[model samples]
Target: MTKRWHSLQNDRPFRPITLLPVTIAFSSGILMGFAPAPLNFFPLAWVALAPLWVLLFTPSKAKAQGEKNESKRPFFLFSFSFGISFVWGVGYHGLALSWITGLHPLTWLGVPWLASVAIVLFCWGFITVWGAVLVALWAWLMHRLESVGVKGKGEDDAALLSVHASTPWHHLEPLLRSLRRVLLGTALWCGLEWLWSLGPLDWTALAYTQSPGNLAVLHFGQISGATGVTAAIVAVNGLLAEAWMNGQQLAVSRQRSAVSSQQLKTQNSKLKTIALLVSATILFIAVHLLGAVLWLQPIAPSNTTALKVGIIQGNVPTRIKLGSDGIRRAMEGYTNGYLALAAQGVDAVLTPEGALPFLWNEPNKLRSPLYQAVLEKGAVLWLGTFTAQKGGIARSLLTITPNGATTSRYDKIKLVPLGEYIPFQAALGGIINLLSPITENGQPGAFHQQFDTPFGRAIASICYDSAFPEVFRTQAAAGGQFILTASNLDPYSEVLMAQHQAQDIMRAIETDRWAVRATNTGYSSIVDPHGHIEWRSQPRTYQTHAATIFRRETQTLYVRWGDWLTPSLLVLGAITVLFQRRSLRS
Candidate 1:
């Protein structure tokens, strides 16, 4: 069996070779879907790219022929397949939800399916191109390492040969040079994340899925933002990849030495390999256990006065939401819900994004009614509404005091691209109009805003805005103690979307602030400062959830420092790669 496995590894083309990694990647993704919070700590993200690494570093005709015709097709196919599989595993949940909810029912059929598939392909195409770039970079670095005479190949030459005959040192070099790569990669990924946060479709992220699982790690997030979470994810994956590579090398080396050496040498190598594996396993277990312990702990609010808050899920349809009557209905529903909550003696009432449906500038039809309700009930009202700003349409969350005083407004800085505003709209306005829903381009808002309540200052964000850590960080820094996230999830109401919504628990944990998330069509909840869900509504339910609010504690180290460790490692990683490449050139 071992021989056959080795034979297959050695003979297979890169396309076929990626099968295991792809399978593992997909399985990991599904596992993430099942238990997104706990299993998310597995560090399986880079495993998706394992095949790409193998393909690029493997001894192939392309490496020898220096740009042969046959190599091009195989390389492209390998990248394309890997991209499709990886992206499909990562993003198919959103697609499935889109279909199930009839948001794009046509997508359930041929045309939409093809279009969705094409979109996925287009997104992955960039990833594929990036992978190719990384491959070329790795090759250059490895050649440098070899040229500089980095010594000590482990006894596992045979196993390494099975994977990549020529670039046997690729794995070893990356491990030894990990510090540099970690630094560079961390910086690069974080920078990219920062840029991606600026995009309008704001909520999607690798760390968001893991938000609900571990509170302490998330507590560290309040200070660091999602960048901190990203760093942790990368660290675990890098460590695991290193450990696996080390184990493989040790195992192969021991086998080779056993065949050719004295009994003592064989015993020593075997012991070393076992020790390495054991250490890796121990580290992995310890990290997850620590995270779990942190997650399970209860958050003690500073004040006990416990404010009663009501979250109204309007469940307004997107098409209606775009129209005037839809806006009126949303406002009416929210106003009615607030009145009902006031009758129940709720201290405050919350509504989802675009609860007013119509742009705020539209003649004050809903405002007077909403103002009257707030004044009569003497209950604070937090509403998600849109406004016509100088740049374009802007989404905002407005907090009205019990006396009907409009206390503060938080404009959503992060806007969805096609849905809110087209990228490069000035140049591609025509194309964008045909493809997107933004009849009038959406505008970006200020990064942070706060509303002063009788209890304390509250920070609020619209749907996509909650995904960006910087917004929260800035708010927190500006003395916002509690977070109110208003979202309209009606368009993508699915178990997956619910799961995705639950990920916001991490935000609470990261910042040590309690969060009241009110969404359209369910998944509404109250999260404690520790990132645990105190209470949540059922999926697809147009109901109101009432919970006692809590105050945030002091800021964490992560907040003060902000992804310091990860970014440093990334810089080091980049430098090491560059140095190695230079040495090879020399």
Candidate 2:
């Protein structure tokens, strides 16, 4: 028998999987991530994770059919992850951030054509690769948790441990068993996202994918912050994944049974149908219930103050934003927008990041026009510009008071990895001109920047700083009543505009602050405390509007406590992984 089996194994060619699941995994990861971007068909995010369910079953299916589950080599699992990452990277990060290539005359100037393209692609590649690794890590954790859930006893000590291994759970009904996956998957995914959602590599959270479009879903930001919303979205995806896996396993069990094919009528179908129905219903209740608790219509505290401010969009072209001509043109456009808003009776006007490009030797030279505008209108002016510091340049938000005094300046704290401040410039500077010596690099500033405005205590943010919730939370904790952010979206396409708008909306919801965003290209908007988009500008359009923004002294639970969900998730995931590993080994 051994000889026969050996001969049979040699005779049959190996096939761990066919092309279908492989295609499914790649397509699902990319599509799920892409749904959050330009097209924003948010519903797809729920099922987008279903393809990864294949990974969970592939090994078990192979085992049940008496095929090798897969090669035991350590690298095989990692290589599988590499494939997952490549496709995901191509579809989501690559497409979402392709605007990096539009860095234009500067990128194109300092290098050969191919090198410039490479420079643009470096970030997308680095992030995609990092994301791929994280996806693989999530898969590993999922498997570990699965083992813990279904296998309480050692695989070797199989003394009829349960009625059956194939059921949704050995001891619980299908609904309860499937709910376990929702918990496990949500925890594991949140753990990984928490690890990455900081500093330079911090580009996304599952919550942002559903933003503005799903206002009810977004209110989760108020309680658990973005991580909570992310957990909820991932949980729905995970339950669906479990349903797919459980259904496939059930079919495999039926196929392998010795009874006649027609004897068993797929007894678990009703159970599975109910489980799915229950899971979907729970998610629906969750979103709306949380929305009601954290709705934008929170009764205004007696201290709530309303400030009408002007939001201006310059719509400057990418090439000119940094050039001398571009600088003058951006200022002229901003001046006109400021005047227009001033005429409309706004108390203050906010301009997008780099609305006034600072000249090399004269750091405050651009302040003249802003000072003049503030003095003439007798209204506050918040404008974005770059200031020359000792080492390099710092992106700053200057608050020009009505008395012609540029009183408050907040330099941007978080800098972009490649675009704003190249990593390891010291080592790479000597090698192949990596420093971009002529280019203005940024210096990190204070963690929180807040000022007293005519309306209330206002906080300021530069373009990318708003991506990190802690930045806004810190300011909110420091008594900031309203949030003001400035951004220049000229180099990128409309995809970034939407992606960025979603992030600012989340900040507004998280901190319960009325957020007003000013953009050089587009997507300037006022986001209410409940995360609703009160008013937003179109992409690449030169427009300005005054919206009544109420400043709230009340802070939300998330803003007060900071991100409690992520740490709790990390702890829960660690215990599960350790317990499962021990159980499996024993």
Query: Which structure among the candidates has the greatest lDDT?
Result: 2
| lDDT of prediction 1 | 0.57
Residue lDDT tens for model 2, 1-586: 3233223223111443345445766777667766675677877777777666544433332232222222333454543433443454455555555556665435435566666566656656776666666666676555445554433332111111233445444334444445555666778778777777754677666777787677777777878788888887777776666666556545545555566432332455446645775776688677768776667465463434767789888888766676878777877888778888889998888988878776423335535565566678887888787777778788888777777666778888888765677567787645525434335466878775676665667777888887788888888888998899998877777778888888888888788888899988888888877777788888888898898877788878887898898778767656655654554454
lDDT of 1 by residue, 1-586 (tens): 3333244345334334345544554454454444343335423442433333332232222232322222355344343323433443353233322323334433422345666555545544443343233323333333333323221122132322333335645434333443343344445545555655654443435466455654445544554566666655544444444444444444444455345444544454344445444544564455456556656666665447477889998877775665677666776777778778888888888888877776664357345587778877798888788777887778878777876666677788777555577788779999866654347577888764666777688767777666666676666767777888988766564654455455567656666678899888767888877666778787765677677886664676555565565466556655666675564444
Worst 10-residue lDDT window, candidate 1: 146-155
Per-candidate clashes, comma-separated = 25, 0
Report the number of the highest-TM-score candidate: 2
The C-alpha lDDT values of all candidates are: 0.57, 0.68
Clashes of 1: 25
Provide C-alpha RMSD values for all models, in order.
Answer: 6.2, 5.3
Give the range of the ten consecutive residues with the poorest summed lDDT in model 2.
154-163
* Candidate 2 runs further than 4 Å off: 1-18, 58-82, 104-114, 144-170, 173-182, 255-273, 296-304, 359-363, 432-438, 577-586
Clashing pairs in 2: none
